[model samples]
Target: MTVIDAVRGDLAEVRAEVDATLDRFLAGKAGTAPDPCLPPLVEVLRGFVAGGKRLRPLFCHCGFLAAGGSPDDRAVVWTGAALEMFHTFALVHDDIMDRSAMRRGRPTVHRLLAEHFAGSREDDGVAAERFGMNLAILVGDMCFAWTDELLDRVEVDPPRWREVRALLHTMRTELIAGQYLDLGGDPRSTADPVRSAWRMTRLKTARYTVDLPLRIGAALAGGDAALMRACGAYGRPVGEAFQLRDDLLGVFGDPGVTGKPDLDDLRAGKPTVLMALARQQATPEQREVISALHGDPDLDEERAERLRDVVVATGAAERVERLITIRAERALSALRSSSMAPAAKASLSDLVAHATRRAR
Candidate 1:
């Protein structure tokens, strides 16, 4: 079943509310563009924002409820909206860096922009790829600005807002730090490659995707230190499992089902723990296969098939799967021991599957 079908009533309510908030916000943005050229840009941003699973917002609401906040509170709802907008900014820039061709089963924003600008700049000799990259960067910046504006609209008291902003500042900082690690852009990255990959997963994927969002919601609800600590206990492992599963999917998932190419991460030689494990376990022959095909810009379906075989042959894929299961269990164990409301606990339990096992 789809996530909407699988989740119970109240969770579905927030999903609908968050979607409405985004639609209304972006629609108004489209109409209010100061320049004629800007409206279409706004529309593109709107379309991009419309495609995600709203995982961040859902997690945020779960945290709020867990912290004893009322379900009727619109402040948490708007905060969820802000989270989704920030996610948009992250995604656009990520695609550019990964040189991804598609997202949500469609051409990525940069590629679309490249095509859009190609004709206009045909005679000026500006390369389409460069122009597209430049414009998409601006679009990402716009989302960054919009995220702050959305947060500004939430009617929370100054103290609560201050706490939330501090959490956001930390989240944003770690997000950039994690990205640099992934890009080998950090000087402090460990020399041990597997440990480095794990660090990147912790900083970039796990914390960004799940941990801080949960805490942000909890903080908004005035959750105390113990409650926020509980949020971390459940969130950190679940988030790690979530990203580990994504690593598997990126290499093995069906593009038709995933709505994303399986080849990109493999092509980028993303320094995932999965790859680290595979390399360590590989025989010399298998090692040669990896060195030959992985990270090759021209890697094709036939070669990717060989690399997939090597990963499975080395037992790396199986090992990663085991890690995901272990991490998920850790999360569930943490949940069972928490003092969260039963409704909050149950909703979070339901979401673990979404976090770790969704096809897309």
Candidate 2:
């Protein structure tokens, strides 16, 4: 089976249920809104939420199952919905910060908002864009607020709920700190960019995206410390591999398949491990190309292609491919050796492939 195919059917089941739960919750939210104007925003949110791969929630469910929680438990599903809401908050805000114009093959939330404002009001272009940014921020804040609402509805044990909350809090803090470091560019001449980039990857994606989500699910099931430790074993390497592959994809993936503009990561000069590796291995001429064009805000497709060549020439892409392989192997080894049930271990093993190799 294809690597992603392993997770496809099983994950689809979790996805459908979680999607239904979110739909019902958001519909209820819209129906009970304090103001007429609020319903429209919720509709927009539903649209935005619909297109996600739901990887976090799937991992959450997997953790629940891994901890011997019953698949029939509504709490796990509801809590997964809550995590999805939180993810929406992150993505919306992330797009704003990235100045991304497209998401999930559609106009980004903030950009859509800007166009809406521009169409409705006789405002200058800058005013409409500013309005869009402000409104999108509010929308992200609302998603954060709704996460509490979703979690409130889930009836887990008090002690377990506390643990889950702690995990979520840590995830958010790490994500924000990582994002701040991300926004602070790593100049080509930085003393130790590879180390910085790896730290950022672990904080922003590894712990936040995988480790905590798995632990959160396990927590809801009252999993013991041993189970939590096992989840970390499978989670950390897989999450880092996931981000490292994503870094490669960002620079080298087809925009048509990935549904993201290829230029953004390069244009932003994201100090990803992939980039740091390239900077380290580059010849002086190749280093010159990266320095002059890597972070240019107005970088075009052709220049982006040239940078891709530099990465390949420096062997950074091949080295990153090796990194992904090692991490995936470590994650799977952890899964195989963990005390988690065989069925759960199998599913997580599948995830190693999906997280590390997905096109989008």
Candidate 3:
């Protein structure tokens, strides 16, 4: 098989292994739940986690192998599964904050919970919505706790474990801080929207999604500072490219393929680099249109299309495409220069392509 094919096969196997680990872990939690009602929450988490690409776990596994750790090590798998659990927690909270109705082509956790509780309330819609948000918040907190529980079970020497714990803590803090920025904190209020967007992307996605996972895995395998630094060099740029591609897909991708409404980002006024660029480069007339149409709760398809046209006409989309290429190249360069295992290098190279160029 080609290197890319081999990497794909290995990633599929890792995904299955991580899924099995998560299934077994959650089953145990469900079986031992303090309250019978908690089992359903575990069930919801299980369902929500089942449909992801499992990219974080795959990257962690690659990092482990890159640092000379055994591919068959169960500790590596457990750590990777912990990362996935943390990701689920983040997504659940994100959906609530965004007021997103759909995730993974179904009602979001909050929406699903709201609908489930609808029958018990006199003011069914309003009360159910409140119930859903509250319960979903608790569910997200549970997932966060479970992630730490899973990580705690992984066997490593004391120093390595300490390093791993530090990385994990840093990752969580960076993600939460990034989310705050995304939710219109001080960073979002900056005059230079593009710079603010990039800063948020680095904190929210680059470190959390790629850099920390790789470094954490490497640390677990006792990799030194230099190797961990190399991982950051490679991972951060690729991670940024991944998020940039996601921003593009949010605005321009087919809903059937993306499993998300294309209009959601526009309506939510997400401060993406693409939008920032469009705003910066727009003509006065286009800016007026953006001001009137963007973030409108009742924004229709026609106006969204016009907004899209403005983005495209301003060349922001093409500029983002160029940026993706630049970052992917930077990642590839780092991979080539590093002394990681050849197989790991090949897998990471494939990952850069997959992460940056995917349609969904």
Candidate 4:
């Protein structure tokens, strides 16, 4: 079989294994829970986790193989599951912060909880919202705790385990720092929107989503510093490209296809690279239109369309596409020079394409 084909086949299998592992783990937790409320939380988390692309776990799997770890080692799979759990925690908190109503095409955790309590005696609308946010926060915290528990179960040797744990610690710290930056305010309002957006992307998405996952997996396999560096070299550019593509999708993608409203980003005043670029390039009249309409809570389809047109007219969307191309090429170049297994390299190449080219 071609290397790419072999990697594809392995990835499909790994994905299945990861899914099963997650199911079994969550089921076990639910079965042993002491409190009745814990069962419901576990169930909600299971549902939330079921709908993702499993990108982090897949990357970890690829990294494990790249570093000469046995594909048959189930410890790697459990580690990937731990990463996914952490991701769930991040998403739950992110949704709360954004006041997002939908995720993976369903009511968000907070929204689900809000609706559950809508008709209760204490269900003033605002109170219901507050209650939902509070509950979701606790749920997110539980998921974070679960991540450490899952990692603790993975049976690596002491030396490799220490390395992996350190990577995990760094990943968690960087993610929190990035999230804090993201919560600071809208990028458009910042003095240097591009710089702010880029920093936030690197922290919030790139490192957590790509760099550290690969590093952690490599560490678990006792990969040397050179291999870890190669992973970082390939991961950062591709990860940034992934986020840039997401930025484009947030403004231009079909909600039905993306499984979330396109208007959410604009409504939230998200400080994406696309928006930052548009802000930089817009004419005076265009700037006024953007400032007035971009973050309006009641932003309607008509105004959104106008904002999109302005973004397009400024050529920011095209610029981002070009950026994706550039970054993808850089990742490929790094992969070619790395001393990874041929299969791993082929798989990473495929991932680079997938990450940068997806409709959603």
As for candidate 4, its clashing pairs are: none
Alpha carbon lDDT of each predicted model = 0.88, 0.88, 0.88, 0.88
Q: For residues 40-109, what per-residue lDDT tens digits would candidate 4 score against the true structure? A: 7788778888887788898898899899999999899999999999999999999999999888888899
lDDT of 2 by residue, 104-222 (tens): 87888999889866888888999999899988999999999999889998898789999999998898888898887788653542678898899889998998788999999999998
Q: Backbone collision count in every prediction? A: 0, 0, 0, 0
Q: Write the residue-wise lDDT of candidate 3 on 1-360 in tens digits.
A: 111233467777888899999999998999999999999888887888888777788889888989999999999999999999999999999999999988877789999888877786777577789899999999999999999999988999999999999999999999988898787677435678888899889999999988899998898888988899899999999999989998999999988877888889889888888988988999999889878877787888998999999999999999999999999999999999999988789889889988888878
Q: RMSD (Cα, Å) of candidate 3?
A: 2.2
Model 1 steric clash pairs: none
- Residue-wise C-alpha lDDT for candidate 1, range 1-360, written one tens digit per residue: 344457778888998999899889989988887888888788888788887888888889999999899999999999999999998999999999998999988889998888877887754534788888888999999999999999998887788799999999998999998888888775554367788889999999889878999999998998899989999999999889988988898999999877789999988988888988898899999989988887888899999999999999999999999999998899999999999989899999988876777777
RMSD of each: 1.6, 1.9, 2.2, 2.8
Instruction: Give the Cα error of residue 133 in candidate 2, in Å.
Output: 1.0
Per-residue error at 232 for model 4, in Å? 0.9
User: TM-score for every candidate vs. truth?
Assistant: 0.96, 0.96, 0.97, 0.95
Q: Where in model 2 is the C-alpha error above 4 Å?
A: 1-8, 185-189
